[model samples]
Target: MTSTARAAHPFITSHGLKAALADGEEIAVLDVRETGVYTHRHILFAASAPLWRLELLIDRLVPRRGTRIVLVDADETLAHQAAAKLVRLGWNQVSVLAGGTDAWAAEGFEIFSGTNVPSKAFGEIIEHRKHTPWIDADELQERVARGDKLVVVDSRTPEEFAQFSLPFAHSLPGAELVYRIQEIAPDPETLVVVNCAGRTRSIVGAQTLIDAGIPNRVVSLKDGTMAWLLAGRALAHGRHAALPEPGPATLATARDRAEVVARRAGVRLIDADELARFEAEAGERSLYRFDVRTEQEYVAGHLEGWRWVPGGQLVQATDEYVATRRSRIVLADWDGVRALTTAAWLAQLGGHEVFVHAPPALAPRVTGAEPVRVLPSRAAAPLVSPLQADALLNAGQAVAFDVDRRAAYERHHVAGARFAVPDRLQSFTAELPPTQTVLLVSPDGVLARIVAAELAARTHRDVRAIAGGTGAWAAAGLPTASGAEGVLTGDDDHWYSPYAHADHAARDAGFRAYLAWELGLVAQLEREGEVGIRLIPAA
Candidate 1:
């Protein structure tokens, strides 16, 4: 039983921390530093806990009682986030160490070093974002409402969409876009827009669409939904949700269309060897490379310098990746579906040096390395979990997630689940929580396996994927609510809201309202996840 959560105050700067200490309040200061730093020296009476442990041990470390907690992490966001989580876990009061250790030392605070150093993976996630470009809410909303004929696609997890999203955006997510573009976004003439929670997926999503060939234009929404909110733009409000994947038939059609689109858009093919030669020859040229998998996958392992980019953001971040529309690009996932789609988008953006397929996973880092396997792979199998279904949902440290069509995700999901679908798995460098092992939830582990491999390929984050996906959640007897959204099942469904309305429709459902509602849901779910709930399957 976790402790009752308390409200947290915005962190004080390094100087601010000294003032707090001088006040001598009976506060529990948490140091989220590498165990090494803690061991060498630390603020008097500061507890040493890593972020990873917090995500996993919150239930035990935070009892269902009352306590005041303070979090201190190197990155500014991490400490603030930790303080927020503490509040959720029933703390009476929570504060973040503003300057973390650096500030403490500046105030003549003592610190310690440990023989066994704490892992710096959590610290790394922050540094990675520095290299990323961000757009605020006002700027992004202006673009969305600019009526520039740009399409804004929400590349977040379906659950995230259910929480809230940008005004007039669609929940496309990252993993499944490659499989469902034709049904969700069949129009090839409109400018394409993409976004995610932050920089990683948005940049990666835009890049994905650019790489894949399409007749229309494509761009990424800088800084994603959060930026939009910060910019003070109004978000469309609604309580709708959906899955971000596609059915078999829809996937096939999208794949077929991708091949044709690439051909029409002039997407070229290159093996590892050719890619290497091209990179060598294209000196002084700026090129953007991305992986359209989940962040966790990229953290586990990935090609060096291959940015862990999600496919959904490809439409928004095209500007950041390629400069002046003359750069080279390469991409791949479990298959080349996302790569081709992104390639096409690049061409639509007026890029000439576009190559739409990716070499095998084991292909050498060099552009012109030996071929590991042929590409343009057949549809991959979805993933599944191994344990008893109900156990997966009810077990300690368990989290239920959605891994199907975008509509299914927006429609409903087991409570307290985090989404890391396949399409955006490649941006691990910029995404992914450094703490806690990952358990991927999907309809079945079928799609989960494809996403899992992508995470393993990108980062060293400890990773594990649940099979049986959301099916396992249902099987595990977890609570579920209905009315969530699913993808457009047929040609008649409105996959791209506000753009394509089928027979008998009013004003097209804009993407802005859809995204805002979804982002709200994600925030809500984070709060609701603290309580334990068990579901009885409908007999």
Candidate 2:
């Protein structure tokens, strides 16, 4: 069966979009191409929502259905298709970019090449405006050799810190720096140096401490781990030394300091009533309520209805979390420090009205993971249990296809299963044997079921989804295979980070190019005026 026909949507010219952005109208610009393709070329502010996973991601990225939405791609074809899907999903105000990125570039507008361009550019602007202090790798090494009373803090996520970090560096993610710095470095004279994979988080993390009026001397490690590698320094791998929780005294002091910083940055403090008002108006005005604490803390207990987005990742990837431009954002945490600290940076980021709230003393809390909103599939495919699937495969009566991430498929999959890209399933499955039953599997059975129904309708063949997907297969003592045995589409769905490069020379080159791109963001921001980043004077 062909795709359901959709009415053509209205188009917005590049000039129209530029003016709307300058006027500060609420809008979300989404690029519907696959992630790898989007990284090569895209609008400077567009967020990635690939067509294949659009249903899974749209509710999180663009929560407000009525909010104005502009779809973009390399050409207009994908954008139009995405617009149709959005319209069917209850988005009343959706339009395609007249000619997509090509039109925007032809009109002399700057086109960016990278993921998270807006957030990285905002970081460069922060560094440019605040002149955040920095120390080179040589100086840091010398200080360490001299046994100076100093602490090196990695500002990336705990997972990133575990992958690689500086010698003796502690993992204190960016938002936690302000909330726990006093405890981490109680001695006023002890130096604090923050680092990340590259420039953005390093600068933002160190600046956060300085802005909060910390007495300790704080500086970002220049160029972060990339510079250390360039300086021929070896990094420690598999380290997980996150700082302990702040005590009551430390929490009190941090709250006071963060309040001052938030006030200075013009972050409004709202009570429960005010937050309810914002939630009530969410239908007309886009509102995002986030619990800005560590995932562990958030999972233990959090205000119901608040999404858990660790503050550090929220600041580093604002575009991903809050796609609706000029939306109202409410941040909350048990202690005021995390919410206030995150709000200060977001308030300065501009375009949005940022607020902070502390949950009531006896507010109802939810436990476990946050709930995800996904579009319901039009049809459900028949499901087979692992034992049933194993029997069919053993009899050579069924072919299994794993429709998950390439890395996941490479790590482990059902024996004799071929990896398939969700969007490329039609072309990829055409070469398969026609008589055998087709079995689909994903990380979970959700995507598999959705795609299996579509494939069965199109191919008029027997198709079934593996119940509970690969996890269930592994749990049932089934044989599995590793490595790239049958990868039909290679690395076409996801963007590869510079650090993910396999070859040392290629990885080093990627690091250099990434650093250069970050350094040049400030100049690009200047060329593209009205980008909506405003810097508040550092307190």
Candidate 3:
């Protein structure tokens, strides 16, 4: 269908969408609102794609332009806007929820709060079905104090582990648990504990080891680091204790174990010819090609068109990467362990057809980061260099606004620039003096440019974008400001994790609410009866 044709009949009723979801068709339901607004209430399976960043993230979130996409917003206004943008970006099968999420609620459908709902709920379901073993923070602390011969492995990304982690915890992100356990805990009699910030990764990580038939006794740290902090334990900050790569002997053993697990889980092993066939069917079906390796390894070399997402993170947050339900996924890695182990969990997660690329050799032709495909700005706005923007701001000739994520804005932005949510930019700028030229800034300037062009057309005022955004300003030795000064929208752009809260009371309350939400997911799934997860027994 053409873009214009889609625009004419671009709405699906809530009832129709619910039927479609249950019918097992390949579809991606996106909630086109900022993170904060999305976290308040959204459809159970919808991915978050704020209107402002639609073009920037559409390719990564939904690779196949022809995949059926249904967008939701508070009342369909923003969904309409996002739909128009997606059509321009070559997506044909796009529609908005007729009355938005409100309409869904009116129809007595389930509405979920929080990000990565599907993945977190799946984690809870896994623990319930598999009966994954776990140890609480208090008991683990006592064991540590008593000098128990056990190893603690953190299943979060290295960056998260470095921020704060439990005592004696070594970083071995989720996907790596099965592949590196032989080296991390060499003794068969030793105990192994896995943890993450919250529950999902920890449970998934521990289970991966058990399913692989590792010799050591493996258990997830119940409630993870959140429970530790709640139990009045201090996390070690700025720790860089990531484990070393497994030796060749260990890697071979891990590969053999992972192969058995993958076979038992029914994860398909594909070759070059099969992958080519999958690529050819991309127009008709959604296909995701992921190099399931560490970021450093991916940057060093990878398949030309494949994207990099660490194996552990991929299993923990599948919805974030694969937006289309029932799509085909291909995981690639040189070592058999990472790709095979990741595919094992994904296969058990159900919905999608999971496969591992069993390449003859690990050689890759491409180098550096995956290239990002961003839609061209609708119109080019006048641009000013960082130095020019600095002078203009200092001389009161132009008023500046930062359009980056709230967390990035709070970290450090161009001095004197007020933070503005892109969707609310026009209203925020209306309060400014008519004669002052508006300057917009973003992390990399792509979003700033896009917003500038739209704002210029709407407001008909002199609007311009900082050429390279705040990063450029800092690079030029210009002054910058930090903290939440001059924030117009105020914490309404992104959802804050409990750890993000500064107030001790609020943080504790947030954690309690979050844990309760996770714990209640299995019950919710039982009531709903359409989550589509299938638990496969380990061999």
| Candidate number with greatest TM-score | 3
lDDT (Cα, tens digit) per residue for candidate 2, span 139-224: 99999999999999998999989989887898999888878877779899999999998999999998899888889999999999
- Tens-digit lDDT track of model 3 for 340-402: 999988888787899998656745478999998877536778999999998898899999999
Output the lDDT of residue 79, model 3: 90
Off by over 4 Å in 2: 1-7, 454-461
Report every candidate's CA lDDT: 0.49, 0.85, 0.87
- For candidate 2, the C-alpha RMSD (Å) to the true structure equals 2.9
Q: How close is candidate 1 to the true structure, as a TM-score?
A: 0.30
Residue 357 error, candidate 3, Å: 0.9
Q: Per TM-score, what order, best first?
A: 3, 2, 1
lDDT of 1: 0.49
| Tens-digit per-residue lDDT, 48-107, candidate 1 | 554423433343233222334557765444565556545544554566765677676766
Q: Compute the lDDT of residue 298 as modeled in candidate 1.
A: 59
Model 3 global lDDT (CA atoms, 0 to 1): 0.87
